[model samples]
Target: MPETGDAAPDFTVPLANGDVDSFTLSERLEDEAPVVLAFFPGAFTGVCTDEMCTFQDRLAAFNDLDATVYGVSRDSPFALNEFRNQNGLEFGLLSDYNKDVIADYDIEMDFADLGVYGVAKRSVFVVNGDVEVTYAWVSDDPGVEPDYDEVEAAVEDAA
Candidate 1:
């Protein structure tokens, strides 16, 4: 997990929209806009779907705070497309299939015991214009999730 106050690593990952785009953490933070980068384990999973749909349902609240929300996962673009379309996602759900972004953010999972492939631990980062992580939450237990109220408070403060 990236430490708070550290500069976020930037990466360009594939998008479900059939375009390769890059998200520069610092660039997003410019003009004091807060960026909510939510990394999930995979697509179509129970928790992941609920997590993303929660964001979709409250997207306007985030927008009101001038925040741009991004959902990142290791799923392929096709899978991401389906997930977004099926759930009526209004934000970009990026494809980090290669795990490069996951590595850069130090969110990779260990597959030794479960025999699962590399997965991103569920996490969220609130970044400022200078690329500093103003707030961050990485789940110690993969089964758990970040506190939405805490995150919303952070977003409000950042705004």
Candidate 2:
């Protein structure tokens, strides 16, 4: 995945916005706002659900830091739409079903042996207003959660 001091790769995907509508990234996500890209293996999986809901619970913290968070996965937009509704997620759930974004970030975890393929590894990247990655964490295990304190500090610093 893109690391700190690296330029964040710009890619737009279908997003299930909190308004219960599908929108393009350019439609709502503020490019100038500090961005938290939360990439996970799948939408409904246990660890993925916890990680996403955790982000939702911390929404105000992100807002206080003037940051916007988006949960990204290779799930279809329709599935993401349902996931957002089911979780009451306040953020966008990006659909990278084509795996283009994951490919670009190079964070794909190989679960082919388990019959999963091209899923994004559990990871987070904090991007500043300049669209440069300020912090990055790619979990060694898919079941592991990210270091929230470190990511929050990065957002604060980038802000």
Candidate 3:
């Protein structure tokens, strides 16, 4: 997985921005504002819903820090579209259905015991304008949610 201070690998995927479209990480990096990627396992679950709603609530704070947040998962763009609408989310959710972006970041989780594999572990990466990771947090237990304070702090520093 990308460590703090390492250059973040870039990828483009379909965005859940109430439309079927694409967003590129590297493209955002060029704009010189910090970007945040929140990697979740899937959509429409209890914990995932709560976590995303929290982001929805604190979106203004993130914008104030000049950080753009994107929630990511292996779900299809269709599913994420509903997830966004149901949660009233203001940020985009990137569809990593092919599992390439998580693999690139080396954060792919194995859930063989649960009969699933290559799903994303709950994690967050704060990538600065320079394409470097200012903060990284990966959870071993999928049920764990990321610390928003830490994430906000990283974005503040990068901004």
Candidate 4:
């Protein structure tokens, strides 16, 4: 997993909001803005819904801090778009359908009890304009969520 001060792995993935579009981490880095990558196991699940909704609720604060937030999951763009629309989320959701990003971030995990394999562990990474990690949080349990206040503080510092 990437630690603080380490370079965040760059990725180009399909971003789903109201419509599908391409998103590139490296390209966003050029804008010199703080980026928050929130990874969840799946979309439409209870915990995932709450986590994402929480981010949506806190979006204004993050925006005030000049930070961009993205929720990531191993779901198809169509499914993600539905999830975003249903949740009324303003931020984009990245479709890691191939699970490549999870592997790159070393956050791949399996939900043995659910018979699910190769899903992204719940994780949050704060990357500064320089593409370096300013904060990192990962949960072994899918039910866990990141500390919103801490993430806000991290983005504030990065900004």
> Of the candidates numbered 2 and 3, which has the greater TM-score value?
3
Q: Sort the predicted structures by TM-score, highest score first.
A: 4, 3, 2, 1
Mind sharing the TM-score for model 1?
0.89
Best by lDDT: 4
Q: Sort the candidates on lDDT, descending order.
A: 4, 3, 2, 1
Better of 1 and 2 by lDDT: 2
In the predicted model 4, the residue pairs found to clash are none
Runs of candidate 1 with Cα error greater than 4 angstroms are: 17-32, 111-114
| Cα-based RMSD of candidate 2 | 2.1
In model 2, state the lDDT of residue 13. 80
lDDT of 3 by residue, 107-153 (tens): 88887988989989999999988889999999989999999988898
Q: How accurate is candidate 1 locally (lDDT)?
A: 0.82
lDDT of each: 0.82, 0.84, 0.90, 0.94
Residue pairs in clash, model 3: none
Q: Which is the leading candidate under TM-score?
A: 4
lDDT of 4 by residue, 1-159 (tens): 999999999999999978999999989877747999999999999999999999999999999988999999999999999999999999999999999999999999998888999999999999988899999999998888999999999999999
Task: Give the Å error, residue 149, model 1.
Answer: 1.2
Steric clash count of candidate 4: 0
Q: Model 3: what TM-score? A: 0.96
